[model samples]
Target: MADAATSPYLVLARKYRPRDFTTLVGQDAMVQTLGNAFKQNRIHHAFILTGVRGVGKTTTARILARAFNYEDASGPHPTLDLSVEGEHCRAIIEGRHVDVIEMDAASNTGINDIREIIDSVKYAPSSAPYKVYVIDEVHMLSTAAFNGLLKTLEEPPPYVKFIFATTEIRKVPVTILSRCMRFDLRRITPEIMTAYLQSILDQEAIAFEPEALAMIVRAGEGSARDNLSLLDQAIAHGNGMVSAETVRAMLGLGDRARIIDLFEQLMGGAIGEALDTMRQLYDLGADPQTLVADLCEFTHLVTRMKIVPAAADDVSLTPDERSRGAALAGRLSMRALTRAWQILFKGHEEVARAANGLQAAEMALIRLAYAADLPSPDDLIAKLANQPAPASGPPPAAPLARPSGGGGASALRLEPAPVFAADPAPAPPRAPAPPLAPAPPAARARVG
Candidate 1:
């Protein structure tokens, strides 16, 4: 056996692939279920593993295969505690075990390819306790191939086990899906990915900055394999030291502080300054689409901070992001932040599709800046409701005639009618007017 020090270099992704259930991250539910099933001897003959790319669907399938054929001096029994490699573990993991067969449906998607599997099910295990078949990207199989697989897949020999992996679970027919015990592998969350990457760096004795790890986590987007691959590149790029500046340059990411500043300039309606900042970032190797996405992300962060102040305490955030984001959240209204998000969100797609991404990004920033100055619908409604109604001239004075039998004419002044605003205020309580004097009988008769 070759020692790691003397062997050719292995990529971090391959070097650190999880060898057993215990090492797998962000899949505790599936791991527990499998453990319970194996303990009870209730393991199914056919198991389907489904998840997005890089989330470990194929890796899970391989692990399942290893579990099925696990053997030791105690006895030949299935188990999930693969902490120690069993009799055939090394061969199986190396994909050289005669009893453990691996197939890629992507390259071989036809009835003939599946026919071989159907024919092989009748045979017994060559050495291991169980004959395990691992098929990857199973959704790529042709319709006829799937139909051919249906009968054999439903009822394989007691000594045989089938494990299928697919990225597109929907593409796999319901008939195929219904016949198997399905385990949906979840994407590794950022928190878990961050820890996992740090652990790997520690084992490799590589130095890494926390902010650099955060960038890698963001880029990974919950994919373990992707995160590891990125970590490898960052380690190489930084000459064994992963720094935030190096990761930013490697990923074409803008500085977090500068990104926050850009957000401020846009929200402050400083279009010229924002545009200048964006161009400078682009010249520094930042991607326009990535920059727009950063704006959208910051908008989301500020919005979250506004609604949930506790979000500002997240460890993934840089000190600048936390302080400035919290301040912006306090200063900016929810409506402004939401509107900025919308503009930037739409503009991200435009930048991706545009012939010139920088120009498209500039236009998006301009639109966002101009839109920030426009009052929200609610603001407009409040303003309209608060305005004073139009003033009218003073009410005309009219004569109040005296009774025919009495003295001279009296003048009565009428106040103008009350002017109501768009949203009128509640009327004030009124005191009863004094009773008017009644006209004399002769005055009433003459007026009539």
Candidate 2:
């Protein structure tokens, strides 16, 4: 009990770390290829894993390291069928294997550090068949360090296997990249992540709402490690039972239903209602920038549903989102949805930089609402072209009347102007009329 009290608890991310390729989620293609390579004994000397942080670049590299040198109790030969525990698995997993070396290129970015690797590559493994080198954040290596590794990386010893992991693959030199077998890990989809989180919670005997799990998945943004970390915090914050409200407050997320409602109001041109909703959300501790981002995401989802009807049935969307989004997709045109997207996207940026976030968000919503009501240029043009033309021919002339004053007086009558017909025909040629004399002074004065 005293030992347990002194030892710190492991976080979920580390405690449930994937032990083998079979346990890796959302990376089936890479796993399949590697599995085939191991079966065929066509393993590459140098391998590079690249992806966003928390997406398992480092984890995959470590798994590869263990697999490269794994030896089952039944046989000493290297094998990929590591379903059973291997002789070197524990040591490699604990980062204490003599044959498997894990290096942080972030701290060892100098040519001297890489020179050590180049010097050591000539030596064979002491225990395992292959000596594995795992370099994390390989892009952080300096130019000189990269240059030092280029020749060896391109042609390494038969007993050596180099594994590189990086979040920024672009920063890695082409020379180094050309020598390695690159595997790009993709972000885990929200559906898969949500299910994974639920499984973990169930295993821990912790109660959780599905909506709460969904919120955690969203907060993770497709990173499994990040999601697990958030889940750990949520479990603690919720006191063993995760609820939607607790998760929302923990992540500072706005209400998903209300955000959808706000979007609907904007699309319906309900500016007042949208503003009120935004205020209500803000008052409830939702960030203005986050709300705008949510609206943008909602707009994108609707656009997707519009283009691909199958997207309306995606499991990633909540029940409310699927129903509301389908209705919106059917109600709004591509042009209107696209315009709304642009407005919200730009407005998100404004809110991010505004002195008063709520004000900026409200202004953006107003812009979206007004823009929704306004017709596109093409629609406006079509409407104007379709309008009916006025009646053709001159208006009837007024009756001519004399003024009370009689000296050289002439009466003048005003006539309505002729209206043009839609696609009017040319009139026949007519004889010219004689010029009229100037009006008399008395008539002019009387008319005035």
Candidate 3:
């Protein structure tokens, strides 16, 4: 179906596209490098910016274009005014400037197109001092087009500048690349992506739980554009408040709440309950790989809690998730949690790549359930050392805690568990008082 109102909402992606060098995310190395070069007036005549899809390659090009074409009343050009915003900057953004031209080489791949560009370069800009030719997907230009433009590219008019951008730098010939200064834009990091998304959500007056924002960040992979696209849908899909539940449904993720329950059952060695939870999720149309992935994140949160208990207060968790996580942490040991994480991660890979992902997932869950009951290598060794040789009738319900020569375990105990009715570690029985004959006799005499 077509969109309800095409023009009503400008997505967080396009709406918040970086307007200047400072706004670019997770490209600090490139931004600082370019900023320093511009300050030193060491910029080259031709340049290339390379990166993956939606990683701000074109945006960077636009920023460079404005920087090069920019001129102040003092007549220094972008060399003096590097800011990519203003009245003239708006024109540059809208692609209306006489000097700044943006070409999509994908559609205009031919010799004549190159010739037309070549012809225009001989004459300097009619208005702006530098004529910037931004060819997007420059790798798409035909052999003839590249050949035709080679001479001008090697040595264009003093005022003509070329800025090429490509998703695949390997496609462009070495001869073409050697003439330009190249900067490879990098994919944004999850932390940077999360912070940026939070800012956008805040400005929109949208209420989003931190975990929901992290989901969007992870979903983006590395592209600010992709994250914004997801954010757009998330904003529209929710009641203007993005929450974990909304993000999960939007991304086709398993319900985290249910996933957590399944995880708890796995930790507690309840295989039947874990499988039942999986079926319930499956009935709700949850993908197995997604469910595993959500579990991966849940494991990560628990691991974080292990490392820095205070991190439980981190914004990435919804309030309820934080509370639940605290409870889960309190109940489980770090070693067991880490082991579960490893098994689930491996299972996710197997399930994701399998022909029958659901079956793979079910099998994976069973494997995890088995892993939950098995002892770690360390524990296995300890048990073997202390095993009651060949027990006959119904082995003890649970193993006893180890102590040094009957002394209670203490050094390794970070925090003691709370007291309960059937607590396994009973308080050491109090020793009987020494025969109280002397003290008792004195007390009896005083009573008499």
Worst 10 residues of 3 by lDDT: 410-419
Among these predictions, the greatest lDDT belongs to 1
- Candidate 3 at residue 106, lDDT? 95
Give me the runs in candidate 1 sitting further than 4 Å from their true place: 1-6, 391-448
**TM-score ranking of the models:** 2, 1, 3
User: What TM-score does structure 2 among the candidates reach?
Assistant: 0.85
Tens-place lDDT per residue, model 1, 1-448, is 5585798989988888888988889999999998899889898999999888898887787788888888899988788989888999999888899988899999999999999988888889889999998899999999999999998888788898889999999999999999999999898877788889989999999998999998899888889889999999998999999999999999999999999989999998999999999989999999999999999999999999999999987767888998999999999998888889889999999999999999999999999999999988998999999998765765555656666676554644466667766878789999999999999999999999
Q: Can you list the residue pairs that collide in candidate 1?
A: none
Q: For residues 1-448, what per-residue lDDT tens digits would candidate 2 score against the true structure? A: 9998999999999988998887889999999999899888899999999998898888888888878877775666655666887888898888898988889999999999999999999999998878999999999999999999988988889999999999999999999998999999999998788788888888899988888887788778899999999999998998888998998888877888998989888888999998899889888998889889888888998899889989876555778888988888998899998888899899998998999988898999999999889978998899999998866755468667777776553777576666666987889999899899999999999999
Clash statistics: count for each candidate:
0, 0, 2
Candidate 1 TM-score, true structure as reference: 0.84
How far off is residue 27 in model 1, in Å? 1.0
Better candidate by lDDT, 1 or 2: 1
For model 2, what is the alpha-carbon lDDT of residue 292? Answer: 90
Q: Where is model 2 more than 4 Å wrong at Cα?
A: 1-6, 391-448
Better of 2 and 3 by TM-score: 2
> What lDDT does the true structure give each of the candidates?
0.90, 0.88, 0.82
lDDT by residue for model 3 over 231-299, one digit each (tens)? 889988996889878888888887667878888888878989988999889888788898888888888
